[model samples]
Target: MVKDQLTQIYTQNELSCMATYSIKAVYHKLMGEQSAVTWDKIVWNRLSIPKHRFILWLAMQSKLQTTAKLAQYGISQSDMCLICADAKEDHKHLFFACSYSKECLKQFKEWTSITSASTDLQQLIRNIQNGRRSKFQKQILLVGLAALVYLVWNSRNSSYWQQSIPSVNYVVKHLKAHTKARIWAVLPKKLSTKDYQWFNEL
Candidate 1:
């Protein structure tokens, strides 16, 4: 049923790929040799992950990291969404199209003046490589995104293991901090501590 709905929503080729197997297999099979590695590929590889596992891992990481009330270390389906409190914990709501994440993207676009392609993860990856940003800027953004993803994952682990709520502000702060450490130089500061705190309180 879900596959049929996805097929109707997307093109035949997209439907076929999305339905054939796991998203990772689809990504590797179709995207492995696309000539140009997109922002998604760059970000995924930066995390030292294989292509297919990266997709699922990223999505899961985003949600699991933010949730503070779930048990510290077990795989279960009872976790609740930390942001909206209206849904179960899941990947889709944690990353691309979540309401809170959308707000975060909105702030990102306004600050960077870089328009994201779409809320769809696949499209984000596809469009990021082809966007009009400079190579330097693209690399910076890619690194920032990668850091943010990893930080979010780490924050989730902290919440689960340490019984602490890792706020979005901490996530963003750690992202900037780690990015700076990695780049080893001063870069333009995009998001602020106030912004991070506000996002957490939202």
Candidate 2:
């Protein structure tokens, strides 16, 4: 079967008799090419914490096991948000729509000076990317946003298992610390004086 598949691909590409074998060519032909997503840089930013990036990636894809998803799978009986306890718990509400999360987002925006009015995760990312902020500023904002998502998800889990949710201020404080430290550790050497000063004030 493998030999037959290889022959099919070879014929489809109309390879010359002298063409060299390429694993890359074979792989792309087998799996097809995927288009790039706009959130790729936001979720995979180099300055963001690895675990935070991972959670952001999952949250961006709506794959986090929120109570709404759990209820749909019969693993949970309650779909109410653990943090707010007033709405269905899902990726959308857990990120910023819930009162607790909205407060956290408000604090984050104040810190980063992100002027976009969006509370939705994906839309906010698009806004940041398209905004007029400098590259460094945008990176800092993305890092902070990623940290918020991670902490908010953690708050939800705590509410579930520990029967406690962290205050929005507590989450925001940690989010600022984590994002600041992460950016400082990998800070680019060529940052402009203006950007550096802005970061220092944050």
Candidate 3:
């Protein structure tokens, strides 16, 4: 049956078939592979919150309303970060380099044992989702990383627009609370006791 299907798939003359295959091969080859960091594989599926997923998607694209982006649109008068007030506010700096954000992220890293989260957005994600980790550990790390991004963006917005950002303690408290709640409510039911124990370690 497979042989018949293959024969039908190449029913045309060899010259025509080869030309057709060559065109498709050339097109894909010309397109090549992207080496840029992509958060897509773990960003959508298995995420517990739609809002968190959306923010993470925007973050991966560097589309958030950091001062640099606002300036690019001719809206922002000051380039200083609303959260940190010292460095220019771009997606990369606002997300991880700001002192305020760094402190908050530090607490989260300590909580989850991911100490190498970088200020570079792509590298930060790579640190969390590398090949050397276990499946359950990777899941925990991805979720924790998303929670950090969401919380960072949220706190930045609050400070930028509302004249207040939650204390670092509050931000960490809320992330752990909301994430733990989501895990219980939405994570796969097949997780074993050891998985549960590992999650607790995070």
Q: Please name the candidate that would achieve the greatest TM-score relative to the true structure.
A: 2
Q: Write the per-residue lDDT of candidate 2 for residues 1-202, one digit (tens) a residue.
A: 9767788767755666527777887888888877777787779999999999999999999999999999999999999998888999999899889999998999898888778888999999999888988999998988999999999999999998999988888999899899888989999999999999999999
Higher-lDDT candidate among 1 and 3? 3
Off by over 4 Å in 2: 1-35
How accurate locally, in lDDT, is each candidate? 0.52, 0.90, 0.77
Whole-structure CA lDDT of model 2? 0.90
Give RMSD to native, each candidate: 12.3, 3.2, 7.5
- Between prediction 1 and prediction 2, the one with superior TM-score is 2
Residue 34, model 1: lDDT of: 54
The candidate maximizing lDDT is 2
Q: What lDDT does candidate 3 reach at residue 98? A: 88
Per-residue CA lDDT of model 3 for 50-115, tens digit only, reads 788788888888888888888878998887888878999887787788898888888887887776
| Deviating ranges (above 4 Å) for candidate 3 | 1-37
Worst 10 residues of 1 by lDDT: 44-53
Q: Write the per-residue lDDT of candidate 1 for residues 81-198, one digit (tens) a residue.
A: 6555566555665555656555554444454455765755545545666787554455555555555555544544555578665666665665555654654453335645654343
